[model samples]
Target: MNAHPDTPPASLPLFLHDSVADAVALSAVDSLAPLLGIAVKEAEKVVLKANECAAGFTVREILCTNETREILRELVKLLASYAVTKTGMATCMTRTPTLDPDALRKRFDDVREGMRLHELLDGEQIAAVQELFAKAEIAPIRFDTTPVIATRRRGLESKLQERYGDYVRVAVVDSAATAQALLREAYPVLLVADADEIVLDEPGIISIPEHAVADDSIVYPEFVVQSFRAKSAAIAAFVQLVTEFDERKTSSLLDKISIPDLEAVLALLAELARDESAHKVNLADTVLSWEEAINQEARFIAQTGGGADDFKAYLDEAVISMADELQLAGEDRDLLLESAYENLERGPPFEFSRAHTIRLQEHYARRIAEQRYFRLRDYATRLIPYEEAVNTALKRLFYLDFLFAVARFSHEFGLTIPEISSDGLGVIKGRNLFLVDEELKGGETVVPISYSVGSTDLGIFGATPLPVAILTGANSGGKTCLLITLATSMILTELGLPVPAERAEIPLLPLYLYRRKMIKKTGSFEYSMRALSRIFMREGPKVVLIDELEALTEPGAMGRIMAALLNHLPASTRAVMITHLIHELRPHIDLKKIRVDGIESEGLDATGNFIVDRQPLFNHIGSSTPELVITKLMSRVRKAKLRAVYREILQALEKERDAWP
Candidate 1:
């Protein structure tokens, strides 16, 4: 299926690149990567990073909604039934070039001529031509020909036959009269060319410019030189390797039917062309040479006398025998044999007539230029559909991974998507998401807190949602944890994921969490204040959580500062501020605008531990009692009776303490 048009944009609204990294690190979200079961690279691609926030949120929404998530889960199950993650898509159907096969064959012949010319040059010269092509940004070909080296046509033909005797054929039909005479021969000697000197009107007789041999040798063309150089270095290296190995070992590698190994070699060659290195000069030429070499081998078999039909079989046997001698086995030996035969497949037919060869080379030059132009066009247009198909599949797969991760996370934490509310938030038994795993591991129960500030219903008369909450409590009484729980739930809800709560009614808004530890250790209070000021300047609906705002200064002084700062805060944002200076700042806060809440602690539990209710109480500034410390120390007493005595004393003292503030 195609990606939806509404797929979230990739850009993030906040800190962009660096912010995600910080969030992932500080929030310990990377621990979820393994649970997703995607490739690390793919996981990184989909992780909740700032740059990918939009897409991630979109995906989160898709997976969070119960209906869409169920459909996606079923699709994944169907894919699992197939026993494969993805299907291979075909790139192209035809093996032959489509731009006029006949003309292309002719062009290919010209290129083959260039390949032959390459065999004449030394390695150093081949290297030079390759460099020239790369710098000139031309097709990697050395098409220039050297002047004819032999005066007599027979002499050059004989040399070509001798050097490439396996596939080379020499036909010396001097004139139209001579060509007619060859028509009577058992083997069909098709007249490939008709020259001005001897115009032959005959079936299978193509035209040419001249028949007589020239005195000077034709220089090898530059196109052929460049193309060959692309692969000459690699071929030369392999050849050198062959020479270095003992005969048996060499046979083992070549004669074995190691398809994977053979494919790996081809893959390596393809990769070489993709390299940013200078040797990338060989990109197209490497494949061309392989094709041209096979064509030439097929020609040798066709033109040679005696057992022409058995030539390929004979060649395969010879190569396999060599492989067997080197101790290659089974598929390895078969692989080598198959490779040898396949490379011998006739690629393109062409006559070696001098005039015809020259004319074809010129045609080849023009074809290469056209091919280059069209290749760019094909890449731009043709590649996109395939890229989109693959990308869509990837997104689908990642969606599945996200579903799996969320399913697991929900089960582990007993999470649920909270109902979207028109007012502020109310969470029942909320737990800190980050600490859930740790607490579970330690066999310590996570204390769940029920909290609320805003109104959840619309009254006929009027209803005012509580937009601000001030939390005050004793030290180590889970005050910070409650704030984190609220902030974390909001963050998760905004991402379209479930929250760690029994039940909740939360408004969807941009969430901003500020903690003292989030500030760099080197940063001063003024730096933090400036950062906070900058955030408040932005205009948007936000849920802001401030933890330990009193850490900026002494509680008394910080209380007044917080009061002044609260006056300037945008009314658009719903804020929860956790502070120790609540008593000092109470008069400054207009009670009508903000709500006061506190976590109350009873005297002590049976173990003499502080019995914090872990539930926020409305309209109360709870006592931060030091008596709980005395009870905790009493629990460590060797004598149980002594602990009970201390607990009773503490309870009595608490009763007489006369509630402070």
Candidate 2:
């Protein structure tokens, strides 16, 4: 089955298990997660889940593996040389604010009712009212609502007037004609209609829709107010993150992210960008308040003395210039100048009679502040419709980071996506990652080895594939390294990550690596047997790797035990055991039932070192060649008697070699 589009793939398991490391004699520091460059906690969680999945031998469909590989490949190609580590995927996961629809609905109702009753709005309510006006693209103004009474209009006007008092005028009219009369008188009448619509296309007449009136008063739509009010703290954070990503991303990088959820986020960001462009406003252009503007002007005036030319320059640069930009009405400008003059006279003294200039500056400052305030407010109000979209965009960014990390890991390792097979395992030109640059005592470079088990279709081993095999070799001919290479390939394949191989085909199965242990205690052999038994008894097909199992017991007994175990193993299971007792094992088990592969050591080179091929040869048993070791040691010794003794031993072994298998 295909995975859900919304669900992110499990983290790529890049780290080798400790058992695998020990079995292969790898250094303790080969972990892949830290190298992945994953920044957020969410990405870390994916890695953790992937590790768990690998341990459990969880099987995923070939379709899912192929799909994941495609995503990684595209990411690698698009993000080539664009290192995520350069900017450092900083922790961007933050708590998002939540909106309660019920609370917002109630707030709208309460504020509308308070406005209709001519009740002075509290600080919070006033802010809400201003927000509503901004969203509706209207300037906020004080106004009162009055009902049109058809009958018993007796004490109605008096009762309404008494309730509203001098704060607002309440004129109870008998018809729309009377309301029109009020509008004609320049009273700025807000006409509210119930069943009968009283539409008026006049500037002063605020026409309330028939459906928007409740109890003969205008009530703005609750849903519209709710939408505006729901621009919570989370939306602001999402905007900041989106902006950052946009600034760093190239068009090519963006084009490569075609995952459904990520595409949805990018699309929403585009919509938000369009909205911002349509209603662009710069909050930095506005001062906090008129008072703050006046203070700033005062400071500048104080710095430059009261010379007429200086004052004129100040007025042109700071006052008239801004007044022309804001387009303040002549009447409003005159009124604000008059108020400033009055305040100046009653306030602190200046160094000179700069009162007139100061008043003009204050007027322009207040007008500019008002203009900028409304612009910013409108911009914020317009974005409320995208609160939920912004939240989703932020959430998907974390998943994007996870994918990017996977891509970087794949690119860095030169890994290949393996084919998932129903049975058996194979790897072509596989190099053990841990041994890539490690300095060996022989000063030899790591050699890539190709091997196959359990399936003839892979074409590495001849006509028939060996499901169970004994791996034999010279003392240090990379027997353990071959096992680790296979284990790494299997684990990486299971986790849906590219393996460190040119090509690989792996079956999904639980992995067991048994490393050699030098425990010579009395019960060590029994303990080893019990551990091996438990692994075999587990009720599932699995891949097992054993390194020098003969170390746990006598060579004769170990060979016999392994031969019996190999013969009894389920046909579906695949196992490889590294042992020096293959010769002894050959006598106890049928060669047809169990195959023996060898890493052969050719005779000494001119440098007096054994030339060994690390890749195992299929269906071949290799000699340990202790005589070659003795000859090398003999050349290093200068004592005549010891060298002569080695010569005699070598001659005796040469005679015995002819009688060997």
Candidate with maximal lDDT: 2
Cα RMSDs of all predictions? 23.8, 19.9
Model 1 weakest lDDT span, ten residues long: 87-96
lDDT of 2 at 613: 86
Residue 402 lDDT in candidate 2: 29
Residue 99 alpha-carbon offset, candidate 2, angstroms: 42
Task: Summarize candidate 2's per-residue lDDT along 417-444 as a digit string, tens digits.
Answer: 7677667888888877556525233444
Colliding pairs, model 2: none
The most accurate candidate by TM-score is: 2
Residue 599, model 2: lDDT of: 79
